[model samples]
Target: MNIRLLAFSFLISASCFSQGEPFRRVNEFYLKGDTRVIGNTILSEHATKVYVRPKGLNDRTEMVYIDIDADSETFSSSNASLDIPEGAKIKYAGLYWAATYPGAKGKQKTRGNRIVYDVKNKRDRPFDLVKLSFPGSNGYTQVQGEVIYDGMRDEIIELKNAAPYVCYSDITDLLVSKNAASGSFTLANVIALEGYMYGGSSAGWMLYLIYEDETEPLQYFTGYHGFSFIKPENTQELSFKNFRAVERGDVKTSVTLAALEGDLILHGDGVSVFKEDTEEYIPLKSRVRYANNFFNSSITINDQKYTDRIPANLNTLGFDLAQVQIPNKNNEVISNDAKQVKLQFKTESDRLFVFFSAFQTEISTDYYQRVVVEGKPDTIIKPAQEKIAEEIQQKETTSQENVQLYGKDGERIVNSRNAALAEMLKVPALRVPGMNSGYYVVNHVFSKRNYALKWKEKMQLKGFSPVRFVNPANNYHYIYLDYSKDPDALYERLLEYRKLKDLKEAWILKVNLD
Candidate 1:
């Protein structure tokens, strides 16, 4: 199979307002126990309200907040953990609170049920809203729909980038919980704030951020600038929505990210992240060898490698699930194509459990094989244009439930890749444009029959978290709740599941395509 590698340079030059900075008056919405981030344009729901503790030390921050205009007086609610550039940090941080409707006239103050207190020095801190401003001289800021945040979020956040300096709200997992986490499968876009030290001038990157809906404007000046306007000796080009690693064995692994087709190749000596475009190659990680690769250092499990490369290595992948990132921001895999993924692992601590879950992921097929030990069911008894009614009628079975559903959307086939089969079976069949169907055997163990309903009940509560049911014999132990309602909630739910399942085997797996 030919793999495609798209060409993009992280070291692109940026300009503040080569064009006019569109106004995105995003200081409008508020949330209770919800969080916001620079990269994430949309605010998210959270059980814990993120507040700033003014007396924060080091990287440990208080409730982070952002004002559309760094100079704006009034502000909206934001979290305390924003990744602000060192230069931008003054003696005090910005803050925002909910406007209370003092009278029927619509005046407001920050009074709501959700109160976030991760930060310290609470009472001393005033209601301030921080503003994330990109140096106009940064790089290209794509004008997207109305969005206040710029991170990689699916569902809630609009897809297209509205500004050059968009933020990736990494808080989804923090607020909504694991199962509700929305964007986890995409390669992350490396967004940073560049200072004059870099090649760009003060006329910083200026792009507009659409807020709430696409029609409303949020913040202005969007584009990711490198830290410290100055170029470090080891500056490398980083792409945001790049790739996601799915399955790996020692060295050679499988990835579900998009294909650039002709530009790059992926190679890692287990220590460094290497990227090559058309003609040249660059070492993305040199000093930071053992990057907590594929997993972070926080939860290190037994590291293993099939390809014995000198000394076995364990590289950390920057952020950790344990670390409290901003809440409710969608930061999933940033792939060129759209595919779904889940948190197979939170960190290396969840390693062995991950392998067990993998077995479950591919379980339906194995289950089907076990169930249909007699032989393959009569899928296509006769000729082409087989009507689903005919298939069912031909079968001695009675209903959609009886025929043995296999995949998501209540299909009969077991293989998810062949989801189209369910549609094809219908009488006046409704068809999904680009789909096919797959089938698998099942070993319905009657002894454990009650397990099925228990699983179904759990799933019912999960709100249809997308799942594929196998044939009659194979059933699930726990039902995946429908997390689509809230990405943050989804992530938290996933975490809860991990806890319930005693799952702490590995970090979320990340396969590279190169």
Candidate 2:
């Protein structure tokens, strides 16, 4: 094997044997590169819907296959619905499905007087493909998904008889092609183990939709997928950051979680959020969810229950899906200014496997802004020459005739016939090919020239008329409010700019032009 492959195999083997560590991060999706500065570039409002195929025979029994498609003899199907707001643009859509498959059926073995089933003798098969039918479609379309996590390899040793696996598919293009955002969708042929197993058998699917609306506030949306087995001895915690919340507005933050193998009758499992100030973990609860039994197989958002799926069971036997708003009127757990938060999942008796989690929260408008120049529409004119003239005129009006004046760097200069101050006010021309070493008060950086120009125009509209940008060897355009050779002056200017609420994150960039 190759060197990288050998290393990965060793790591997996070591993790399987480790008794203390039970949770692992398998995959993460988020905004990357300079696009992160746009704030709302990847930010959007989102909605989550879930349904289960092969639902339980009863509230207490294990999961069983109940095919919703009566006409199809070979396919097993289930259905769910999607409700999106009118006129909202869909940004991304991801479909996720997970199941515990212990292989095909066979005759039971006679051990002494008892009939013992040998699950190890069965062949292992992981399903990486499923069929999806859009609303009003006549037939099912095959969707090939990438495996996010598969525990089948560790089944006999670690996961027992429940060889759980999760798969994810980016269905954004497929949804966009249909131009239908809200309708009944069907999923079929999800291969999973039925009948009885060591742990309870379960299978289900969930759809996450992220959309953009002009009326909605800018918000950060992030999703993570992995297979983590949580039991009485082990707990899972996920930390989120890189987004700031609005302090004054009606801040709304929510989280969606999906898991399998949680029994309906079992208790002593809950989810909590870590509060930094009090150094305590606050248990999350809703109208249907309790602090002790948070993962009891229910589909709920905020305090409202969702009953728009085929065979919508109050108790899903082993599947659980929940979306709850944080710091609601009843539960004031998190603050508005919290930049980071950690979610912890724990269970005292039940053994559950968590696969997917997503978070969404409103952000400050200062994260991104477009400055419109006063009285100028659709264009930005250079104010460098005008600003220079204005500065010289102001100095001449404020000082005594022929009096010595000081530059921004505290250098004294004699005002010889009003020419000294004008010379001092002239802007320096930087060399294109040579290094122009200086300190810059940068507000933003963009990889594209067009984005930099647009930002510069916006800054000009906001009365920062002398805003300048420079392109160095790194090829990224650095937009700055001021530039100076003196480090002290640059530091002072940076402090002043940072005082503005919108520019609190503004910083200094030391460019070694040489």
Candidate 3:
């Protein structure tokens, strides 16, 4: 990839213009092959012609022309003029250039001698370097556009053909950092000699302003310059958007502020926080290595302050979920201020990698698994209820003169006791193969035949068609409530029995018949 690096800087050169002529001087930079460096030359010193080598002749030549008419007042271009707003801070200022000289046809030929210009006639000619005056020389500057040739290209201009276009340059950081931010400058040109036949032609240039507009909403500038990771060597305000705070126990793990998210895990004895932004202190026991040193910084948005309260690392940032407010007149964060929220946080951690991800805040928690066994039926649970029913039956059979044996009322009383005992018995289903239709719940399983038969007779008395299945492996008999072809109908009946008849432990069992 051909990464086009922008070359821009302020030129504080001595004047070359007349008393009232609007003059602009530019500091020069050259692209030697893939490398870019400041040229020892300036724009105003060349007498006749500015020269630059074409790519066809020398792969090591690229020349930069910067407009350095530094002033604090209003600046204008051919199309636009901007008055320096009151208290407005310039964030980025740039110049745009269009390469019209290396016409579409000029690019097809790789011949080195394609661009050649004769500087013999230096008066009233396009290639001649002459000075001119404009209306805005003193006050409201008329930022007219002019054209010239690349100094590096001129060195090999006779032997090479230049590139077809010159891309735009962004010198915002350089200009802003120096505090020599230029508000206005006359536009100039960087031209290449196409040849004797299609002599001297250059690229078109324009001026544009990128300033901190306080009246407008906040606009976020993203890039290496916009947001940066907090380090001891470097410190800057990081803009945040929709935010949330999450706490697990005494240690606050995560705080979602704006578009940034980071995790906090405190390990050592204790952490003390001293916020430079708010001048607040959190008591500490001792400081750990990575915890105490890294990410212990703060940023103030609005009236609220957020600092690294607990020891943690910033793992991720930049997943905008909600709008946050911009505090100052020159807004640091660019977003809607409608749902503005003030957040104060002091976080700390040992190992931290601050970045941006789609998932804002994620909690990593440990999970557990266990084996669960459903208990057996109460018929199996309470053996005493069955024993009591059997004892009553034995007493009725032995006492011939008892009213329980002779009278219809006595029979009804015995039947009611048997029904109550049957209701108490719970039938758990055992899965069986080939019983695809439907099968009943087996209330009890017995090792002996007599006990199974007795329960089967009791189930029959309880209005259920009981079935017996013998398990060959265990030599035990399984007593089921019924065997039905329709599983759904049997399941419905089972539900009703479980609800109304107190057969709560009842379950459907499938049986296989070969």
Candidate 4:
């Protein structure tokens, strides 16, 4: 019996190690370059004054780097040769700049100027491009051969304090493969001076190049669930590890989730990684927090710290999925990537609800199994639903008796449609002693006099005393709910009636009150 047990344990261990795992690596390199004014350039032609700081100024020490007041200004910089690591090649590169001050709050009506860049390799000619123009760049003219900056911001002041906003331009595929070396670019800021407008930069320009030695195979797993009537003080645990990844080799895995955020009175929320058989929670290797807004809260995975509250209204929940890996002693995720994972939340109030639609990502060798929460015939909201049902049933019964119209003193009167038409036709015409005049406003206008009289009667039945004004020029009648001899007082009454009656097309009718 002991020998048989030992053999069975070896087989389990062998099966666990047989799963295939993919490898992925990411590297970031910064190339901080020098920014200096290139004299004798076209940018200086239309200048009231051009101010370009000396090259290689420390960003912290320098308050302002480049300040230009010219109608057009240009500055040039050369990026140094990249110190490529052995066996690693560049996948992509991004050029970045920071605009520190002279925000929209400044005297200038606009924030950043129409800027363009001239980027090129060491040997080839330059490519003229605009910086981050979106929705289409037809409004802005672009020079030939230059790649426009994809990342542009109209507002420079993003925070409460006057902080600099950074801009990035992707030049990865623009560069000629991994074999290509040095490159250079020139920044041209075209400022239209209405009354001496100038802009400043807070920091120098830099380049971030991402390199990868080898590409890893990617896999995706997705699932969706919507929890309803999740009262406060209830814990909701959703498991997303229904699917399995490739069962061969050890691999590193990270999960990404996108969910709709609804009203939830939850005090705490988090995710957990567990070993299915033993049911042990896996520890995280590290935790990174990002800058996010109220709706887009930052998320922490390891310690399970999450930011942002579930809003009462329907809002797009932009919580960053915390990236975590399989637990190991060396802090490397070498375990089988098929381990089960769950996202959990805790609520202290009885009015909390949480919802998730799906989780999708490109991890190497993953599988997905959908978990559905079946609808209960006896739902928690059956009471509220029953109440609405009762109200609707009552309305249907009362609708029959409601057919009888009543007058102001609660006496049964003729129904509106037939009675209104009959009474209106009895009146010969509108009686105005003098030239019809007053500060009058009309909710509706009609060319036919009979139509106007009928609408007036309809308004009376609804507890409003509407008057009709005749415009002899167009032979039209204007229906007015209120009027005054005092123009100001008439406007005040018109405003009040508009709100009380929910009038959208109401407007003051100008007429000669002779």
lDDT of 4 by residue, 132-185 (tens): 211212222232222211112223221212222223355555543325333223
Ranking by lDDT: 2, 4, 3, 1
Give the range of the ten consecutive residues with the poorest summed lDDT in model 4: 1-10
User: lDDT at 378 for candidate 3?
Assistant: 17
Better of 1 and 4 by TM-score: 4
What would the TM-score be for candidate 3 when compared with the true structure? Answer: 0.20
On TM-score, the candidate that comes out on top is 2
TM-score of each: 0.16, 0.60, 0.20, 0.24
For every candidate, C-alpha RMSD to the true structure in Å: 25.7, 14.8, 28.7, 29.4
- Can you give the lDDT of residue 213 in candidate 1? 27
- Which is the leading candidate under lDDT? 2
Stretches of model 1 off by over 4 angstroms after superposition: 1-132, 137-514
lDDT of 2 at 261: 41
Task: Put down candidate 2 lDDT per residue, 419-503, tens digits, no spaces.
Answer: 4223333444334344467766678888986677666555544446434445665587767777679755455455556666556
**What is the descending TM-score order?**
2, 4, 3, 1
lDDT of each: 0.20, 0.55, 0.29, 0.32
What would the per-residue lDDT of candidate 1 be over residues 179-255, giving only the tens digit for each residue?
21221111111222111111110000111111122232111111222111111122222222211111111111111
lDDT at position 439, candidate 4: 50
